[model samples]
Target: MFGILVSAFNVVLGFVMRSVIAKFFAYFVMWFITTEFVSVLQSAGILPTASALAGAFGSIGSDVWYFMDLCSFSFGAPLVISAYATRFIIRRIPVIG
Candidate 1:
């Protein structure tokens, strides 16, 4: 499920890049950076541990897929909100445009 979301995001990013080479480059760099950042966070225990995340659903007798969806919403919702806010803020910046 998370894999699918990441793949879909890549496709959208590809369209934004507008060139085959640029698309590939962007995907690779984004993947590398995201992978590393997640790794570091996991290692630092900033992000939930896999076993802990699984246990969270198990305690409530829910499946991992549902938990993944919940996690997606938990993270994605704020990001979408922030993106909108950032866009508005950037447009209002007199020097940016």
Candidate 2:
């Protein structure tokens, strides 16, 4: 009974650990690739920087800026981008998809 219990525990633990490690590795790779891709786009002037975004926001009327600030668009933009990126990456992974 004791041997069986230990074996079962080991199996469960191994499965959990494997899952955790796989997910961590996948997310890390996704993040690294996303970072590099964003860097290249920014360098190429295809993507605007934070300061440029802020400047554009400033140029807009105060009411519009206030609405944006209230809606927290600055925080939402990156979050939405990350969500889409994760979805894209996951779809590319056969095992997960």
Best by lDDT: 2
lDDT of 1: 0.66
Relative to the unseen true structure, what is the C-alpha lDDT of residue 18 in candidate 1, on a scale of 0 to 100? 82
- Candidate 1 lDDT by residue in tens digits, 1-97: 9999999999988777788778678668756665565566568986556587567656654475587687896688558856875565446444432
TM-score for model 1? 0.35
Over 31-70, each residue of candidate 2 has an lDDT whose tens digit, in order, gives: 7776676667569986557798677667788788789889
Where model 2 places Cα greater than 4 Å from the true spot, the runs are 49-97
In model 1, residue pairs whose N, Cα or C atoms come closer than 3 Å (at least 3 residues apart or on different chains), thus clashing, are: none
User: Which parts of model 1 have CA positions greater than 4 angstroms off?
Assistant: 1-18, 51-97
lDDT of each: 0.66, 0.77
